[model samples]
Target: MVGKCPSCGEWNTYVEEIVRKEPSNRRAMGGLETPKAKPLSLSEIEPGEEERIDMHDEELNRVLGGGLVPGSLVLIGGEPGIGKSTLVLQTVLRMPERKILYISGEESARQLKLRADRLGQISNDCLIVCETSLEQIYVHIKNTNPDLVIIDSIQTISTESLESSPGSVAQVRECSAAILRFAKETHTPVLLIGHINKEGSIAGPKVLEHIVDTVLQFEGDQHYMYRILRSIKNRFGSTAELGIYEMRQDGLRQVSNPSELLLNQDHEGMSGVAIASAIEGVRPFLIETQALVSSAVYGNPQRSATGFDIRRMNMLLAVLEKRVGFKLAQKDVFLNIAGG
Candidate 1:
């Protein structure tokens, strides 16, 4: 006689199972929860001054919407070989008054000290630890009670409850969640260094970005000395703000006047060069626009542009021909935004 399984509703899916009871020993992976508070009306809530910690870097401070807010979780992501670690370390070294905990899951204390020495600034209050276990990290946090905490790279840290390996989706999600909970409970600001995937997005689930208070992206070509720190998401500030830096041997230097440095001072009388005024996050600056017009040597004219949108260039060229009455439609035109 055939018997159907009630759950699966299939005759062949039925099977005998053995159940065994095991003692549960897994401890909760979050900070101690406080007693729930009653909801307050909007009018009953009083706004207090937000204490911000200065990073001592003007560019960084501007990108962070004036300064770093306490109890905020900020994530900085970038491509490999970018100056993400250097930027964070330099900022931390400048803050001598604040007690900082530099947690490194990828590097050792000796290596960090060596880098700090090369940077030529050392803070006595700064502490370094080479650990990867999330639980143990929390223990150290409780013991040290630092004013600011920085995680070198979140992808390298993991928890014991997760069966997946480090850098996995499950591990990254759980570790970030734990950190967020701890930050909120302790009212301590946490800075997280994150890895970017091939597509340039943060290497984790989308929910990870949602949990953070601010998200900053460090972007630049390794071949170039210029780097841009941009805010992708900011709960307390504007997302349109950006910071510029020049990578040097000692450390990353803030570019106070990016417009002056970006413009070519000697190219005033040069042909095919134009200067245009632009605004980036309330700052007005001048930009150099260059155009190159040449005869088409091949049968098909090649059009190229850099640092500016290609379609916009095409539309401008069409306008020049139609409105300005610039003949020579067969000529090749190339445009570029200098020092982009």
Candidate 2:
């Protein structure tokens, strides 16, 4: 094992692996003949809008900066139970005209079927396959010839080309590269669901984010029913877009106006409660903020904040004392975002 990665400059990140090279024809991009280079000036290139496929879900489409682009690679990463699979499956099931191939490396066929039944959307063009091997996945893709492809959790996929285990840095890097080639060659859009590490970044090599055309992050507290989808990187659209969803018994439902759900009208005259307006991307919404100030029981006044930054809370308290002539030195201050 290498002490550090030469490319990424991370310590102890390398793993020894045996690479089995295949024939030229078996490779995704190896069989093509060499072509002469052609240079074009800025004026020579044609400018046109990219063709996008409507996901039929407004919240999802807005986060994607309009719609899904054909032949693009989109990577969605989130916590394990963040409803990544449910969101993708629901979107594909809504489109009955498009031929979609849903490849699950983590869940079984029966499990997906049960979830689909709960979603209550049926599409005859959607194909489900439980596969983990990269070679077998490609074989199925070739035979099916789908317009769109969805891979549920990329960490579970492994390739025979490498000796390393699945989810390894080398394996993820190689497998994603091969899949990207296939998507571009066939002009088919591919959606990859990924797991986030403890640090909240997508699991596997950092290059996985760099390789994809778009990188979306699914975020929300599991306890809370609301879910947020944010676009971190987009090659064909703006990155400052976000989508919100509400988790229900049936499935995830789109939340167009999140402010209405976050605000509590019943707490209008309640003390220590205030309504604050916040904007995410281009959308503005109101959020409820709760503040409690009580006399300190101990020698030191305790300062605590949840869903809101404690440091910011402290700064606010200092402003109140100095600017507003409020003596809060011996008080225990607590702040919280009510709907988190």
Candidate 3:
């Protein structure tokens, strides 16, 4: 049995699996043509503005610079049941003009249909296929010639070039590279969904993030209805861009003006409550901050914070005790962000 993993430094994480090698002499399936190469001077190349397709969703478009860039590979990652697929499906379903091909490796066609019905009308001519073999996926892509491509989760796709199982480090890396080459060569925009590990990073090799053109992280507490989409890496847009959405029974609803829902008017005159303004992307909104101070029951004082940095809270407390001459050292302080 393996004791420790040299790659991730995790212990007792190895599992037993059988791998069958495939022949390398088989015909290529990814439709990647070897183009003739030639060297050119910097002045020989022409420059022009990149053409971007409008995503139709304001929040989504803002996070992706202005719109979706052609031939770009975008990867969206989140926890289980965090609405990664739902968000993408809803967005693509709204675009009727674009011929979209959605390839699902984790769910069946009927299962996806059920979710789509709940989401709303399918405006686009979207084709759904359930497949895991990377080679066969290219065959479907060649026949469909879709304007946009969607891969539900890259980890579920396995390439014949590697003998390792799907979701393995080797498989994820190779599959992503193949998809990247296809997107660049075909000038097709691809939206990829990925799962995050327990450590809150994308599962599989770190090279997966580097391979994509853009990386977005969907985060929020499952118990809460609010979800935040943050851009961790963007080759076309600013990384500081953020998108906020509210989960609903039908689907995700965009929050254009979040200040209205975030402020609790009922807590008007309550002590230890205050309102603050914050900006995410280009939208500015107001939020509520609540603080509670009480005498410590035990000899040691307890400091806790939710939706805010605890270390910053401690530093603030120290500032109050020293500069403001407030005796808060022996008291308990609890801070929370409203509607977080």
Candidate 4:
């Protein structure tokens, strides 16, 4: 027998790491029934997956690995104003036929409506809730029984049982855990929107990511009209899937061909422009990488990047010197994603 750990209420904490010394073959215990039933036959088993959650975008569906799988929990995180909520709202809105419930903590129904109106086309079947309490949210969910549920920013939601303030580490972790359990038990696919820290990771305890079946990071610069959704964890599909979108007045439009958007169209054979193939999910993409190596006038060599990694830039520069004999230690290397 197993029990919950009193310290953390986690089940199976006292696992039997080592076998106990029992009397030799003490009549191996069996089930209460006389015999277990036979497994289901192949004919009895059902075929054909349930209808995919259609978002009306071929690229989005492709990145989702043939559409949204039922009972899947997806966590979407992004920087503030990076279009995470807008992208999800657009996705749900584009699916005019699918039953969707949009739970917003950062915005009101009227605000969402205004944005939806700006987007031009939206489904009337999409439900909206602006509450933060998990119990209340569950109550509404039961009443609505939506095919898709969007929680706008998970950190803003709080559970009544949690004494900590909303957005706190405790509350974020607890609310997400409860939602994950509810999603799995009810077989309802949930899309959780989350905020990102200044450090460019999903804000909140790392445990929150582990609780969900998929972790998607929405990234892009505010100045640029482009946004990227990169999967960090995916239990239902490949994690390397990446979805690119171009923010416009009508809504976030999917980039059918990302290479055309990410590469510099007017290169003119730029000295720093370099295109490389990157493997994201099950697909390989050719992305333009621009690196600028300038003499560092400031006392501290400042490193700036648009969509590339700063640490990786430093490492690459070091390699260029150590391997290729290009002494760029005192130079400032600025890297960017080139175009949209």
Candidate 5:
């Protein structure tokens, strides 16, 4: 259970063995670097037009840059109970007969199946596993060789090489790095779900974001029923792509037009309410901006914002009254996004 470190070259730095996975009959195919390979043709190495999957949802397809790319690493992150797992589970289930391996460190197969059943009839090719160790998941992936792989939440998976806890900075970083290496070497597309901290950022190390090919953050206010999928980093597709969805009793329905979902038209022509178009990735959407100006009853004024950047709004208001020649410097201002 020992191997030399690739970086430090320290003998026995890696524990080659850990909580072992169940055996499988699948074997890795030799890569292009095989010794017996024939001379390559110009067209052999030339890539054809990218092919994509059609999951019957335009918003999801748009976020995935027309569709899921083969051998791509996609990281999905979100706040708790925000339907990160639900969206992916439903998508994989509804996919058109593609072999898929799903591993959940937090839930068992029976539990996932119960939810899948409630989601209606799913494809038979999707398989489920409840595992915590990265090595164990790798074995299942190698054996199944599924078209798609989904890790429910990467923060729960661990690698034995690091002695730290599973969700710690070091473990998250190392585990993600190992998974990335395996996916690239094997040319198997993998989807990793992640937990976000209270600060609205991914819980693990920042480097975890750098390791993955695509980073998708699922964002929505707990009080609101609309959700947004934003691609922060994407090597295979446009980084500016945005996906919109609405939470209904059945499941998440794609919102082709987000303007209706993000704006509240009940209060027409309300003061201090402005609609602005914000661009994420390569797509642009309309979001309502709400502001309230109240007299400073006491000597000290309070500046508060919900869902919007407080500091930036403060700076903007200051610029408005000072440089832009607006009045009322003594008023207190409150700002918030309609549905964040």
Candidate 6:
């Protein structure tokens, strides 16, 4: 009996559509390709550094492994109200020498202007446009000839070729492919802002991540003042690099010394506090670790750790009991890593 799809195992969830192959009237974004491919020897290939544009934000530059690479498609994803737009806008505004095109599908020109005004940095080279149509965006890009292009969000963009709504898997994939092609052909860097799913992944098909050259993830708690920019993937640089910023009223302020900012000076003489040195990439920094030892209030002692590996902590507890001759089996122990 035809009941549910055996593959998906859902009842009445399947729909069929007739897809027609129609000849395109639209001209190719890249003129008809007539060039043949050829193999080059290792000696024939030029050995030089890839050209990059300085983002002017040291933290951002550090995470990017230097700066924005030419003709690169970079995708930045974060949760709502996570300052992804602010970080991008501020970076573009700081680059006064380069012409930047900021296209927003989610916000109006007035709203962006208000944000820019609050940011307190103005550049005559920056142009702002509110549009969602992918074709129209390309037309604007052709006329503007911007050094850099920033789309506020990719999910809000749609192409006329697709009958599906924007943010659908089909629409997201096609629009991203179009943008990627344009960036490569014109040698213009494109920055796309994206939303995160409830599962904390970039909200689109997995192919969206594969299409871009670099993927940056903005992560932090909204209640906290600090945010972390981590490179999830980078084609031209190391992915181990990360950047830190402090969310302020003006804009995102780069945290040059995260160790100093994350450490609490008031806890200097505290018994439970200790400092540990760790290295991320080639950069070395100090992190605070706290441990609390107390008598068990309940019949069973409770062991809790935040930001510290629970398994490792248990191993340490076993060491304390076995090697150190401590009668801590019946006691409660809690460990936490500060500012993690």
CA lDDT, every model vs. true structure:
0.87, 0.88, 0.90, 0.79, 0.81, 0.89
Clashes of each: 0, 0, 0, 3, 2, 0
Pairs in clash, predicted candidate 6:
none
lDDT (Cα) of model 2:
0.88
Give the total clashing residue pairs for model 1: 0
Better of 4 and 5 by lDDT: 5
Model 3 residue 144 CA deviation in Å: 0.6
Candidate 4 structure quality by residue, lDDT tens digits, 1-340: 7598889989877967787887321111111112223789999988986566767877667667778878788888887787877788877887877789999988999999999988886688999989887777877876887888999878889876669999999999888877776666567799999888888888899998889888888887657788888778877677667788888887788887777776777877569888888876666778888878899998777788887677887787789899999978777878888663
**lDDT-based ranking:** 3, 6, 2, 1, 5, 4
Error of 4 at 139 (Å): 2.4
Expressed as tens digits, the lDDT of each residue in 1-340 for candidate 6 is 4579989899987777789987342443422222333899999999999998999988888888899998999999999999999999999999999999999999999999899999998888999999999888877887888999999899999988889999999999999998887788668999999999999999999999999999999999765789999999999988988799999999998888889765787896679998888887767778998899899999998899987788999999999999999888889999988886
Provide the lowest-lDDT 10-residue window in model 6.
28-37
Clashes of 6: 0
The TM-score of predicted model 2 comes to: 0.87
Model 2 residue 53 lDDT score? 97
Model 6 lDDT at residue 140: 86
User: Clashes in model 5: which pairs?
Assistant: 240-281, 240-282
lDDT of 2 at 323: 100
lDDT of 5 by residue, 214-273 (tens): 899999877889888988887767867788889977788888777776688786857888
Tell me the alpha-carbon RMSD of every candidate.
Answer: 5.9, 9.6, 11.1, 10.7, 8.6, 9.4
lDDT at 92, model 2? 97
Error of 1 at 128 (Å): 0.3
Alpha-carbon deviation at 118 in model 2, angstroms: 1.0
Model 1 lDDT at residue 96: 93
